[model samples]
Target chain A: MAADQLAPERDTRAVEAGLDALDGGGELLPPRPGPWQVFVRSVLPPVVFMAALVGVWQLAYVAELKPSYALPGPADVWQTFWGTVQDGRAVEAVWVSVSRGGIGFAMSLVIGTLLGLAMWGSRWLRAAVGPIVSGLQSLPSVAWVPAAIIWFQLTDAAIYTVVLLGAVPSIANGLLTGFKQVPPLFDRVGRVLGLSTLGRVRYVLLPAALPGYVGGLRQGWAFAWRSLMAAELITYSPSLGLGLGQLLSIGRDLSSMSLVITSIALILLVGVAIELLLFAPLERRVLRTRGLTTDR
Target chain B: MTQVREQAPTRNTVAPPPAPAAVRVDGVTQVFERGRPPVLEGVDLTVAAGEFVCLLGASGCGKSTLLNLVAGLATPTAGRVEVSAERPALMFQEPALLPWLTARGNVELALKARGVARGARRTEAERLLELVNLGSHGAKRVHELSGGMRQRVALARALAQDSSVLLMDEPFAALDAITRDVLHEELTRVWTEQQLSVVFVTHNVREAVRLGQRVVLMSSRPGRIVREWQVDIPHPRAIESPAVGALASEITAELHREISRHGR
Candidate 1:
């Protein structure tokens, strides 16, 4: 009876002790991967896949699948690529395309973000422009090249117009998606904290919307690069300078299959390089910080 | 059994207490949309400085709406709500900590919002985290911490605002029973230590009895305070203790009766 009477008194103390045991300095998250692990995960697989693809292409060449002119061997393509590299033509072609893509993408980012903010701020604006933006995202940038050339001529202006049309809607819609996904409770939290209207948008809304915006930027870059290539291919003139797409078109006029293949490979390589060097790291950092990455 | 007592009539225009109250809600009526019934009608509540009150009722009782009104997140449709000077800090059922920020960064954001200098912000955030027994875990991400720990960080962040009162809307309702019980003790300790006027809203009867100095029960359908109980239990009272259980059961019975009335 005495022990029974005392047991109830000890329950709270027992619970406190149990809680202390449970608290054990909290959970330990996995350590971030080192540079070598990053290389194995992100770099190695692509290198292996590309090497195997080239090997299969060489085997098909040995088997004599097509005429040597129509289907050039890997060695012929490599020789063409190497010659262009040695003559500095490759660097100039890549730089022209990259610089155009960079400039066009930057302008798109700014305009798209502003458009998204305007839409978020006003229901009328969102209703008016929202569907048009979605429709633009689905429309191929290649389709806009003819219209752009007619509007702005065969100068860089035509290429840039196509690039802007390709990228802006994707970026704006990305930001809008980000803003929409933000939980309503966050706004209430901001209000209770006495944050000013600008402060709430700056500190709460923008940060909440970042992951979506970054996804938008990545997609925008893809669209701009594709549109830039399409514009270059169709709008080539003597004064317009030789981009990768223009180099490929020149190869077509001269009937050099290997040169065309080399130019196409270079264009693909540059797109992959920009995505790997710039956007991949940025996207990883954003997702990791937000605990949206599964590795955490 | 402690029988339910009749609510005192609304006493607006009465002389103020010698010590100023932290919150004053006078005949608050909230209608979210036109031509619909009000969410809260003529609901009046007052919290004195350094007091702990729990608003207890079934779902749709406007307890959360009432807390939002007190927190100034939403304005009452008719009645005036007055907070004695400083803006009250509010906590939601979810932690609401920014996922981009670490637990410490979340607290620092609040300090920054309050215009705390950059030089002192870090140490002050640490001190607040320390107050919640999460000093060493401040560097962890929001996802890294356990559910109970996240709520503690939230409490720390709310404390960072340096508000006179804290409004909590079912903050611990999502946690497991054991964790909730542990948090109850942690909350009571912090409540006394901070000397904050707290208006805690919850549906749990025992939770109300465990932490509140006064438990106010509200009836739903244009929510109004129907009865109030002053918990005379001493400090550090266990949730399983007879005193808490007795008051909790009595309140639970009344709550059941109140809830049953809606079925008919």
Candidate 2:
């Protein structure tokens, strides 16, 4: 009876000692950075970079290194910007291009995501359609302008067709890469946990492939934007209103250097805005949550 | 021979009442290539319900392959493997937790795959975390936890499956010595409390003796069970104990011999 009692005490002491030894390595918790610190760390560097870039442009203009018409001064660009806004055409052009790109890009996203899923899910489908998608990706979106115009007769549908051709392959390929890269261990774990095929796709497969999928979406959007601009420039219809591409064409036809510069700047600004304001945040959130990218 | 007979009654009494062994492997042979020799040849073993069995072998001994076969991730080229109930849960050397999920979400995923209701998942997940003494770490993301904490969370996730059989492939090999010892104790307590049948594969003989009731030693190159030792030592066996050290040394010597044969 005494031996039994002593054995329990000894066991408890050993467990306590083991636990203490492990805990002696100190806190296993990660230190959380303050919100202000994180915000400043993330936001300040980009702002500083932009400021430096603008300053350099202004300095180059002041130095008079190039003629105003060839390389317009910073002031010239700003004045043109204000003039376009005053005429209300700048806002109008932005609205037209943004609306068309939004609708066309949405269509491309759906088609691409579906195609990607098909490519990943079925070997036969991939064998039949995979190379065709790769070939499409290699052909520049501008190359499709003539074909799109001929097929849709210079209508909005034709512009959308070009955008779809440009974006679909990118999205599909991105998802395919993502799906293929999911670790076999995760699949095994999923199977042992009783995950059905659909369940595995929904949870493990999709989440694991998200980074690659996001990368594809980013590439797809770039293609969609470029394709839309190229199609708009070529297929000029009165019903299409006046997009940024049309403004550039009109500027070229009328020989208005200021209008040309303003239109080009606006196009560049919209692309940067979409990337920085929208997709950048989305990608950062996914990466940060997945612990793939660290803010510090 | 007399000692084996003397211990038979105690073994029977200790084993939980079950129709057959929790896992049964009969003449199982795994071949790497059609023309090559088999990795595991004509191996037969049975694990009783609630019993802890350790498979100790050196590198290239195909111990992990055997575990994988039992887990149903790989098939034996010859013979059969049978599990009494559901598929066994598997734990790897690395925690292998989904990087995107919190500690609780990782466990919840297991329950979710088993079709547990969403309303009950949170509670059940918390319960599992509590069982692993990490009840407060439900919201901690995978990257936020230390290596030891991550493995504990993985252990919780494995247990959440609630399967009769658990297959562990050196789950603590990546951890530091101190953490591994602590986890060994934690694993022992949980295994006894839950009454699980475990087929733990490890290269460390001390680890095998520390946790298992039966340590099965396998020879390399067409891995086969060369010997089996029944550890009569009680729970929380000291690593430095005379019996534990003696068995460990014996197993190590056997492993060295098996490795040298390959070199020759």
TM-score of each: 0.92, 0.88
DockQ of 1: 0.36
lDDT (Cα, tens digit) per residue for candidate 2, span A183-215? 887887788788998898788989999999999
Alpha-carbon interface RMSD for all candidates, in angstroms: 5.6, 5.0
Identify the runs in model 1 with alpha carbons over 4 angstroms from their true place. A1-44, B1-18
Mind giving the per-residue lDDT tens digits that candidate 1 earns over B172-249? 999888888778877888898888889999999988988987889998886888888777677667788777787788
- Best model per lDDT: 1
State which candidate has the highest TM-score. 1
Clashing pairs in 1: none
* Candidate 1 interface CA RMSD, Å: 5.6
Over 4 Å off in model 2, which ranges?
Answer: A1-73, B1-20
Residue pairs with backbone atoms closer than 3 Å in model 2 (clashes): none
The CA lDDT at B240 in model 2 is: 55
Q: After superposition, how far is residue B238 of candidate 2 from its true place, in Å?
A: 2.3
Q: What DockQ does each candidate score versus the true complex, computed on alpha carbons?
A: 0.36, 0.34
